[model samples]
Target: MTVELCAQKAAAAGATYFGVEYYGECYWGNSINSASTQQNANLCTSYCAGNNRQACGGLTGQLGLYVNPSNVVPKEVGSYKTWVTQGCYSDSADARSLPNTYNVPSGTATTVEICLDAAAGFKYAAVEYGKECYYGNYLSPSASKQDSGCNMQCAGSPSELCGGGNRINLYQNNAYSQPASEKPSVGSFSSIGCYSDSGSARALTAGSSTSDSMTVEQCVKLAGSHKYAAVEYAK
Candidate 1:
């Protein structure tokens, strides 16, 4: 069977390791059983019949084994940001329609967290229609868009919005929020951890309560009572 089919079979069978041999052969097993035979990824040079761009298995006597990263928790690359709306990163419509199933099947990821985890191998992760995930090394600046258009709710989590048609929510592990070197001024607020500073240089008005279970909204409201421009909650 094809490499894609093999991977699906392996996942369905509760196997953590999937291997391909001789371009057409597929192998599946758990990590404990395949550790001894693990080899460098370079050795797996056989091109898959289903897709020429991806390497499937290895030469004779060599097995191309891949570890399933479904259960692995992805590192917080940093903050998330919108990428595209009403447009696609590539010209191919199929890529826009089926980000996970097109070209080569990446996997079935239904949530943002799962999509990010599946896309760990790539520099960027994108989600569409709340059920599809795509990975890429780079994104064109021309595909930028506002977050409003990408308001489709994720299938796994109704509260979280994914991307709508022709739209994609992009995220990167390297994305980080840069702290402002200086404080905010009037008509602005500084988001320092869970607290927000109203840009006032004034000392935090005399009394501030320390609560272990305080939300940002509560903190902001409390700070407003004292006519203070800043609210800070310490752990």
Candidate 2:
């Protein structure tokens, strides 16, 4: 409540302001006036807890100005339901009365965050959170653990994962990996023609580079490990 009141006053004063929670215990200022309004908002409210939500569930809401509203107010949004609250209102109908169903998951906590932009005092809009908000999942606001929402970004093919300063490998992402390297199979069979296991020995053994491998009906190999034949450097 204090923060919201302060922000409204700060905005009215024509001075950009920010509210931050530092050291998990200390609060420097409920709202600090500054020239960098947007940056401060992101640093204060858009921390890892919020950023990670983009990767878990895929939510992409823009920073709304003042389009929506909630019940009974002094023309300013209230706490608890503050994020989605637009300018002052008198009822839930006014709050839910967006020009459109603002892009977001319909849920309880989710209802707390919305973005709007009005040409006048209070409007509604869908401002993009980050450049990649559309690319990730809708993460929860409490995603600090590894099992839940992502920390930075989801662990992709090492190179594509979050942080993105270095890479572990192209495959070992999300606790997964492949063998060091794989060798191609060989059989002294056809150099051409759509082929299969036609020969008695089938052309080659699993180990013998020149011997073809045969399926004993007990060993069901992948449908496409071989043309059932072995050829030269032909792809």
Candidate 3:
């Protein structure tokens, strides 16, 4: 690919540094190390795939590196219009502070706005390990606020701190409204209970369905029509 195209893609993904190598291959990362020292510009003699006039990289390990011009590191990601910072809190791999929902997309950088948008309907939103986003209605009983601990910068906005290892930078959404719930009944299938599910490991793995305006009743009816014994609704 061309240098401009690679840089655009990297910038869109919130990457700070990007490089083009081997004519068409593009690479992206947050930091540049000593091993990636600048080489002679003439060595990058290979032509770009998209633009034949431009040189991409050399046959050797010489890379044509470039910095994303659009990348802007925000000073703080704590507060939004209706969302306020809830201070730094402790978390664990076994028990998260906000366990209602979470999103961790691999290789995709994270920002405060991204986390807040994902947790829009929830009461709480938490950013952990710089790249992880978690949402919940209530904090875990075991979790507690710490005087100091959150030290890691956000992956997307490096100037803004997200959270340290096993820690979470929590935020509270004041405009949250609880969803209506009633005893779901569809052809003898009654409501069982609420269960936790994750992207890696699903509680109900077989014959799943999705809907834009999903409700407990619709999910139960869909499952009942399909002769499924159980149904799960996730927002």
Output the number of the TM-score-best candidate.
Answer: 3
Scored by lDDT, the top model is 3
> What TM-score quantifies how close candidate 3 is to the native fold?
0.49
TM-score of 2: 0.18
Tens digits of per-residue lDDT, candidate 1, 52-159, equal 766776776766666665533222123433322223232134434223432222322266666666665455676776566777665654465553556566554444
My TM-score estimates for the predictions, one after another, are 0.32, 0.18, 0.49
The superposed Cα distance between candidate 2 and the true structure at residue 81, in angstroms, equals 35
Question: Tens digit of lDDT per residue, candidate 3, span 1-235?
Answer: 8999998888788888888888878988777673654455678889898899988887789777776534534344658868999888899989878776556455346777778888888899988888888998988998899877787777765656787788888899999987767566656776666667786997666667776787667676666555444444443
- In model 1, what are the clashing residue pairs, if there are any? 77-173
Regions more than 4 Å wrong, model 3: 1-76, 179-235
* C-alpha RMSD of each candidate structure in angstroms: 14.7, 20.6, 12.7
Order of models, best TM-score first: 3, 1, 2
lDDT of 2 by residue, 159-210 (tens): 1112111110011012123333322332332224434544465545552232
Taken over the whole model, the C-alpha lDDT of each candidate is: 0.56, 0.24, 0.76
